[model samples]
Target chain A: MSTPYVRRFDSFDRVLHGFLMLSFLGLAATGLPLIFSDQPWARRMTGILGSFEVAGWLHRVCATMLITVFAVHLSRLGRRLIFQRDFGLLWGPRSMVPQPRDLTDAVGHVKWFLGLGARPRFDRYTYWEKFDYWAVFWGMGIIGASGLLLWFPVFFANVVPGWFFNIALLVHGEEALLAVGFIFTMHFFNGHLRPEKFPMDRVIFTGRVSLEELEEERPSEYARLKASGGLAALQVPPPERWLVRLGTVIGTTAVSIGLLLVGFILYAVLT
Target chain B: MRIKHWLAFFSVLFVATLTFVAAKGPTNIPMKAPPAPSRPAVVKAPPEPANDDCLACHGDPDAKSDTGRRIGVDPAKFTESVHGALDLKCVDCHADLKKTTDFPHPSKLAKVNCAGCHQEKVAEYDRSIHAAARRQSAGSVAATCVDCHGTHDIRQKTDPKSLTYPLNLPATCGRCHGDPDVIKQGHIQIGNVSDLYKDSIHGKAVSKSGLMVAANCTSCHGSHDIRKKSDPDSRVFRRNIPNVCGSCHEGIKAQYDNGVHGIANGRGNDKAPVCADCHTAHQIQRADVASWRLDTIRECGTCHADKITTYRDTFHGQVTSLGFVRVAACSDCHGAHDIHGKADPRSTVAPGNIVSTCRKCHPTAGENFAKYDPHADKHDKARNPVLFYAAGFMKWLLLGVFGVFGLHAVLWLPRGFRERRGQAKHS
Candidate 1:
């Protein structure tokens, strides 16, 4: 078998990705007022946020951040495609495609859950996880394009028909619902709600694979890494800088609290 | 002593003589009847009693006719009535019944007419067209107490079974006016006037508001003396139109007097729009609903068809079809009851006043654009060239966008899902 490369995301990529997620959360929080204007408590929230004008400004700022992250990420991807010629990174390989063997493996995994079979031969990434990643990209593209049009209505009015506003409203609302549903249900299950992960996973933060974790979770990637002598090169020194460590600790705590509050408020409002 | 003896002897003689005179005196006088009236004149029949109750003093069939039961009504039935329950009696209305049943029936008994008992209400009713027409037509279907109030069975209006009860009066009056046989026999024009009234705004509001002043059958037509419309003395006559309609619409009438429609029509000028011209007298309705407004338009279009046709083709009309209800109607700008020609100073549609009037419903309407007459139709020349083309263009544009996006959502959404699935499989 050919050796596989295991390159960890650099610090800049990790921080930028974190900023993108944070900005996304901010946009969602502020823009939701338009969706929930009729709700009684939403009135109070809008009032506190200084009515529609302020909410609109906050949404615009978050959108700007999101666009910035998108541009940076796109440039990085372009560099990889042009200089590194890493097109295979996107498609991975024929093995990445979900196959009939995946169904068998999935069944075996379920059986293992029931203590009936050994853990199935999961490759570098599970089919469900792969599905979620692509859905995020699809959702972002549609929602972002529609949102931009809505944000700059006067500009769009010159080019677009007035009727497009109604359509944009429908798409934006539906896409938002889809994004929220997936993030809460599927993403939560794959990333946070698992028995091993429980509340969260550290992989996204450390951006490093442990020897044991790699062996168990992605044995094939681990095997290829060993062959290519890339495993030793993949060391991240566990965030040795104290300020960075403390900052991460505080940031995670704050983000988690904020997320929990958002979830609770959403629950109260919906129910 | 001698004087006392003599006085005793005299007293004995006196007693003997007095007893003899007393026994003879009454027998000697003759009995004679008192003198009657100097010239005997013929007497007329007595009048009916006015008391709400006829049974109290007269309940006994054998009750003395000379005194207590002088005024005659059938006491047997009266004793059984709801009036009897209240303990009212005949002697209350027939105040002089005990004195005499002499001819001319003692006007002292309050004359016993319903008008006599209810003078103020009766006087007001007398002024109505109904009363005047009845008087002029001379007993032509002239309504009296017995027509509305049953002769003996006149229950208090509070009783649901009474003819005057709110729920039952319509049917009660409809009995004569609505009945085909009755109408035919009475030479009355036949229609479901009552059914048509139930559809009117006044009829609905009378029921909802429970306000007695709201138009009921008796309100438009005088209660006691409904008159024919042809009578000039009638309240509904053209000369008396403003006063009759102004009873409820005083403010509108005052405004209309300064308007073009209120100008005199005889001196070589064309006829002005009167109350009935715009708002049909009996068929008046609230114009809030689009259907009602459209009906109003059609009514106005009878005289102003070109304007209506143009109005129908506007953007406002198109949005109305799209179910955006807060759109403009004729009355939205034009005063409803007090409409006038645009030249009149008091007219709502006059150039100086139209903006404020339009702004009542359309807060965003431009001031200069408001005065531009929406109803002016270049009758056949593709009316309101700018507004017509613009509204049409917008309508189609909106329709197209909705259609395109709907199609995209239907076709591309699933395609997008499939493509994402393919990408997921590859990754």
Candidate 2:
């Protein structure tokens, strides 16, 4: 029999993910060259954006898109928690929260990686996924804030020290490098590129997963939802083949570009 | 008395005609002496060609100008001259000697005619400012051939003893130029040109090298045809500077000719710089040297006033202003020889080319690195808001990131360690 499917992310989240992917990649492509401008490759690559001024224009445009998606995502979460009173998403066993079991699970996962223990059974989200989720908030907060300061120092100079510009330059460059590094390497591998998920896990892009994937990977969330008689309510038809195909195409393109960016950053670091 | 006047006139005219027609300095002739005078020895008359006769009176140590200044001619010094080499006799240069035999050689003796045999050189000298001043009645203060090269004591330029020799040019030109009395006459200021040259890179090289090859008074300024700088034909004229400097620096000349200054000058802007405007004429300093490096920035500031101010405010500019050589300066990014305008695609400071230009100092530089404008004037908000605010925002972001994250990591590490131990014990 064909496996049943469960809706993990909604259509709104998937659409937001698509925009975030494009904007992040755009920012990276147009932005990294400036950071590595001394590189022959970077100098040549920046020409693809027409000129430095055009590149800057595109960068700011993409930055605006990214911040918009982030803000909307947060607002959606706020509306759910404050108005709908969906404490289950925040505090229940299926919630994306740092519980005592999460600490044990993290330790257990490290032990498993080292061949010292059985693997930890995840819920709806693993400790590493939560870390990845929160990392965006952190990266965006740091990178975005500093970027705005460098972007419009005169307006803010009335409230802050002039020397802050130097500090901003340092932090913006270094923190962006760190964020790019984490997203391109640790986040990509854990979320999609791991052997179990290879060539991808399009749950975020397609908003669905098969019954077996949910049962095996998030057994606790599956069992708890079933016991509460809410599991059937979450079940849905498998995503359309065209939607899956589109996700594959878009996701693959994003991953390929991300890998290339990581390679450039690595080269920049070594040489 | 009439017969005596007739004899003097005929003899002087005969000598004058012979002198003008001679193609070269007159050849020495063994003169036939007049019949020996049995009269007192003091009354004995000398023979023709008259070298010894004139030398006997005028070459004496006590021979004096009208002001009683000694004007003695040492025979030894004269024999080394080109005129002396050809064995020219005294009457060759003094054609009117017959008229000067009466007692004190009339107040004004015939002037020494260097132009007779040196007609080509005199023609060149006539075109020079020195000659122009004399012609325009700037005074008899202007230089003449004899002023630079001694009258009877002149020698071949190759001989170290010659006044016109390359190594001796500064002193030769300096004699009248630096002479307070001559300067007071107001033809040319000279402005301690000799002293300035002596302190210059060219001067030090010439002095230390002890060679005629190093640049000296005659190198930039033509020897026989030196003119005022305002003359278009002058070697030091604004339009001619690149060519003058290019004589020795061919590569730089080719580069500079395509540069903005060279282009400006080509378009007839007199205010545009040539080599001297920055390097200075008599006091050129080597830019690679210490003090000269600092002065080079200041020299460029002479033309680009506000640029220097902006450049100095940048990190590179600030360090350079503090005399740091490791940092970049005006010529570093703009280029020393090939400097172009910002609109030019080849300009090092242009949007497309700045990355590579800055790469000289910052090897890791990317297009973003070039975005850090070296000429960014902070006061210009509209132009620099992006860079300006980016810097300000980064400061607080860093503080917030470290503050929240530092606390989170502090809380997470201990809890995770405690749980790991508890899980191990429970198992």
**Model 2 TM-score, all chains together:** 0.50
Give the runs in model 2 whose Cα sits over 4 Å from its true position. A1-271, B1-48, B61-67, B98-104, B136-140, B187-190, B343-345, B350-353, B388-427
Q: Can you write out model 2's per-residue Cα lDDT over A1-271, one digit (the tens) per residue?
A: 6679999998898899889888989888877775665466675666566666676789899999999998998899899999999987787576777788888987887666555777688888888788777777888887789788777755555555555554565566767866776677666766776555667888887899998878878888888888989889998988889988988998888889999998998797699
TM-score of each: 0.40, 0.50
Q: Chain B alone, TM-score of each model?
A: 0.53, 0.74
lDDT at A241, model 1: 50
What fraction of the native interface does candidate 2 get right in terms of contacts? 0.02
lDDT of each: 0.57, 0.72
RMSD of 1: 19.1
User: Compared with the true structure, what per-residue lDDT tens digits does model 1 show for residues B175-294?
Assistant: 666666655545555366766776677777665666556766765555655555555666665656666777887888877665555655322133566676656666777756655565
Q: What is the two-chain DockQ of model 1? A: 0.03
Off-target runs (Cα >4 Å) in candidate 1 are A1-7, A93-117, A240-271, B1-427
lDDT tens digits, residue span A29-107, model 1: 7655455544555556666886556766888898888888877877987898799887755665223345565667656
